[model samples]
Target: MPDITHEEWLRRAESWKVSGAHHIDGADEPGGGATFTVVSPRDGRVLAEVADGGTAEVDAAVAAARRAFDTGPWPRLAPAERGRVLLRIADLLEERREELALTVSLEMGKPVTEAYAIELRAVIGTFRWYGHLADKLTDESPHTPQDALALVTREATGVVGAVVPWNFPLTLAGWKVAPALAAGCTVVLKPSENSPLSALLLGRIATEAGLPPGALNVVAGNGPVAGRALGLHPDVDVLAFTGSTAVGRHFLHYAADSNLKRVWLELGGKSPNIILPDAPDLAKAAATAAWGIFFNQGEMCTAPSRLLVHSSVAEQVTDAIVARADALRVGDPLDPATEMGALVSAGHLGRVLDHVGTGLDEGARLRAGGERTLTGTGGSYLRPTVFDRVAPGMRLSREEIFGPVLSVLTFDDLDEAVALANATEYGLAAGLWTSDLSTAHRVSRALKAGTVWVNCYEEGDLSVPFGGMKQSGNGRDKSVHALEKYTELKTTWIQL
Candidate 1:
């Protein structure tokens, strides 16, 4: 990398901001729109401003998408042709990776290195994966009698409304956009007002990559205004969302209240990280446990916030985890050496602090951290907290606390562990560490989550389907499974 100082990178990020109106149909629209100010959580300074879109902008964007799907060349093109456009988009994103990643860090307060390395890389990979998968989608022909032939195929679901949260803005938006485009659907994406810079830039990149005027559109604003507009838009055939469970329900209501559009959600999680008695390496598991909860400042929906350790090795693992948590460095996100960064906003930081106080009140013993830090500009950073001897009913144990806090609980046997792990209202993702193959298989089946990591945490493969069970929300995000959610099945019968 260049010897780019932190201030220089911050300058680079601010320089890339879009001062124009939202991208509607391959061009910048007029700018009499309401604007949303972007603030840097690292120091509480104004970074940039985005056109705060609402129902009127949403109607225009969705109408553009619907027109592109119904009459434009985008849906009329062959699948491979669409794939080529997506590949071009991937190339453009890869070329401007540093700028996009820096924008995410400035807007959402994650470490720049993580935003670039992990999140942006995944963004490119998702587009590329679906780009390749597009041409491979073929019609299914089932066996039939001599006089009849059955042809089954999938078709696009028209316009998609994608409302993404600030936590993993670009990549989570990728989860919706890639598959929908590959399935030959047009999209109107509403990125969170808190983190709209990258998605707005994406609109220009997609247009530059040879997409049609209305193939992709972006409306940036608060959820109540822009997000609800997408959900309630009659032309929008599907709504894909990634955020809190509290906000996820609003989309369902919008869908029902309007056209009953298909809604795909990847919501919050209070996932379990289990370390069995026969865990291969307790120390290694301990280190991973710390990373599992503390990574991204624990802004991950699939974070293993609830650590369930076998009683035989609970103290050993707990102490090791505490040591690792204490070693984390909380500082400015632009600093490449920093391990943790600030929350996305002051409101989010307050939510996290309130959860910490509730953990103390509910009697979860604070083993490591539970205080605010980096309060010079505003209280945006918190030390990675570890609470031990937590019971089942504690809010920190049962509910989703989307922050860098770990609640450690103990279990005596496999049955008890399964019971405790499956106790939460969420079923997003879970992790287990054990050497025995039988134990791994048995416990994985018993747990009630969409994805389970045996001895690892938050590891993702582009081809694997990702979503959750129960209240963690519906539908898949990656792989061919995601494509299914964006398209509808049709069967054609012909007499020979």
Candidate 2:
């Protein structure tokens, strides 16, 4: 298939002006009172003006979803019927992959090539995977006494409140929506105001793919208003969220106070990449580390922000990492050849720079890329930043900057490395680079993270579960485990 041209992509994006908000009951409803502008991070251009949906809008979407779940045609359809519609949706998504990738890049400032390769591919795969699994997940009867048969069944948690973040909007939305739809649940999705375009377009695509009225909804608004409303809505049976730790906590609180609904959150992280002295190739290790933290402008929740190196190889690894970080190409996200794009926005860029300043104040040495503004750019760009001699308790070490900033710290031994890696309260993910079998096995077992890579960083597969431990929040996002969160398992007993 031919790649989507920049001009064609722009024209298609512009055509989505009327589709930005309140997709409820199979129709678009304009905002009642407030509006917000979605800007392109590449040049601070206004991409579109979206309705800042509030309580009223959220209520309408949720009510629509509830009605669909209770009395609409979506839930009443046979599992095979639902699966057929979802498969059709997958086919439509594949047909427009290039356009969706361009939309993701324009609105979120991700490198276009990376957007196509990473986000779009993953999202399309998610839909196809779940579509196939929908009918296969039907309840089965276990062999037992003739009079007492056990039926193990799974049913959808009605009216899912899916709140996705701006960084990876479509991919995250797919994570929530595909499984929920597969399990026969209707959804009221609230996309982050910063990047609502892709989700809005996805909503339109669902309509074209034969998704019944009210089966899926999208509301574009800020977290304080629309997000809070969805979290607290009584009819919402399950809440699936991906964002910062603070907001995840607030959502949990709201779920408790409002309706005691089931909640699933994939929150923030300060993941560590431990480089041991026995690493096979220092250059490869350094390159993977750079890609792990710097890719997507370090906006991923499970970014490997902390680099724990063995004392013996600290200097060599740090020098290699610095070289790789300096070589990154920073430019406009729309340019197909651009390797690094701007931060999501100027405000987020400023916050990342502020964290760099804090690192300096707390005694971490600014090794490279700490200066802001690439020589010729005016957009929200921050040079890839690296900090050396970072202590465990420093602000840069403890907090998540969510930018192209990396912290380097050294450890004398395996025990020390594991200790340093697990020191943080946030245990989302960790990466270890070592050729020693015992060391890899021991450290991987000891690391307090939900996912660990022995010789790689940020390597994820759809079949494996993805989530976090501790304050990073609970619940898995991918795999069959994710399907469980969207469903409620019921047990039935019979008297013979």
Candidate 3:
């Protein structure tokens, strides 16, 4: 497909009619009297009046899911039959990729190109991948004496409640929903209030792909209302969430307070990207570091926000990164030429600016981009910021700002670099650039992170698992292991 012009994208945006309602039982319904205004970060324009769901809507969605799980054909169908539905969903998503990508770009400030190329690509691939594997899974049988036979089987764990954040709304939801559905579990998905339009569309698409009436439902509301309700729902057998660590803790508490449903969380990160003097290519490492921090406007859970470089190469790498940051084009999300788009919201932009202020107050040198940009456009825009001479104890290094902000800290030796990278409470991901084979092996093993990228950043495949450790959260998101979250093992013993 050829790339569309920016004017063409703007024309399409003008005609795009967005829906704002709770998707339940294969239909759209109005929420309880209240509504929240969704403002696009691209130009701070009001996009739609979304239903503000609460306990009642959550209960309805959960009940629908429960009924589907207990009595509907979705759970009872043969594994191969279920796989066909998932494959159909993937095809449907492909047919409507333009509509979905436009919706995500308008709702969350992601560049339309990225929304098409990266986000939709991931969503389609996930459903297709899980669909292909659905019928391939096999149950286990143990050897026993002739008098007795034992069989162990995997059963769908009833209803699944998935709560995803604003960034990468569709992709993150797919990570949890596709596998759960493939495992034969009905789902009640709660998308963050900031980005709900796309999820609502996805729910409609799933129904068109021939899912049972209640196989998938999407409720849009704030974390305290719909999210909390899903977490505390008694009938939900499993809960999967992707968001902040602070919210992850709330779900854990809600589980303890309710039926103790199995909860899987993929939370925050303050990942470090290290560059050594003996790196294979200093310029390439510097460029990747810039891309790592600035991608998606730096609103990613696995974003490499910390840059730890050996003292011998720190200046060259930092200077290269600053040059790249300055050259990035931040503008309208619908524009194809935009390399960086607006922040998610005005409030988030303010929060990021506050962190920049804190870094300056704490004595870190602001080498580039310390102020707000493009204020006349009424959009939430910030220049990509870089802070050098940062100490390990600084808040800029320790906490997740979740924006296009980078903190560069210099280390003298391999041990010091590894120590700095492992100092964070969040252990979601890390990246190191080195040419020495022995050093790469030793350092990769020493880093306390779920994924360590050697000489690369954010490169991954669907076959491998992705998750976090320590304060970042627990449980994997991708791969066949994700099925473990939505299914349970059952043992049956027969005596002849």
lDDT of 2 by residue, 182-280 (tens): 888999999988899899888888988999889999988999989999999999999999999999999989998999999998988999999987888
Q: Which stretches of candidate 1 lie over 4 Å from their true place?
A: 1-3, 11-16, 30-32
Tens-digit lDDT string for candidate 1 (89-170): 9999999888888888888899998998998989999899999988998889999999999999899989989999888888
Candidate 3 lDDT over residue span 1-496, tens digit each: 3479999999999998888999999999887879999999989889999999999999999999999999999999999989999999999999999989999999999899999999999999999999999999999889999999899999999999999999999999999999999999999999989999999999999999999999999998989988999999999999999999999999999999999999998999999998999999999999999999999999998999999999998999999999999999998898889999989999999999999999999999998897888899889999999999999999999999999999999999999999999998999999999999999999999999999999999999899999999988888989999999999999999996
lDDT of 1: 0.89
Query: What's the C-alpha lDDT at position 186 in model 1?
Result: 95
Q: What is the C-alpha RMSD of each candidate to the true structure, in Å?
A: 1.3, 2.0, 0.9
Cα TM-score per model: 0.98, 0.96, 0.99
lDDT scores for all predictions?
0.89, 0.87, 0.94
Better of 1 and 3 by lDDT: 3
Off by over 4 Å in 3: none
The per-residue C-alpha lDDT of model 2 at residue 490 equals 84
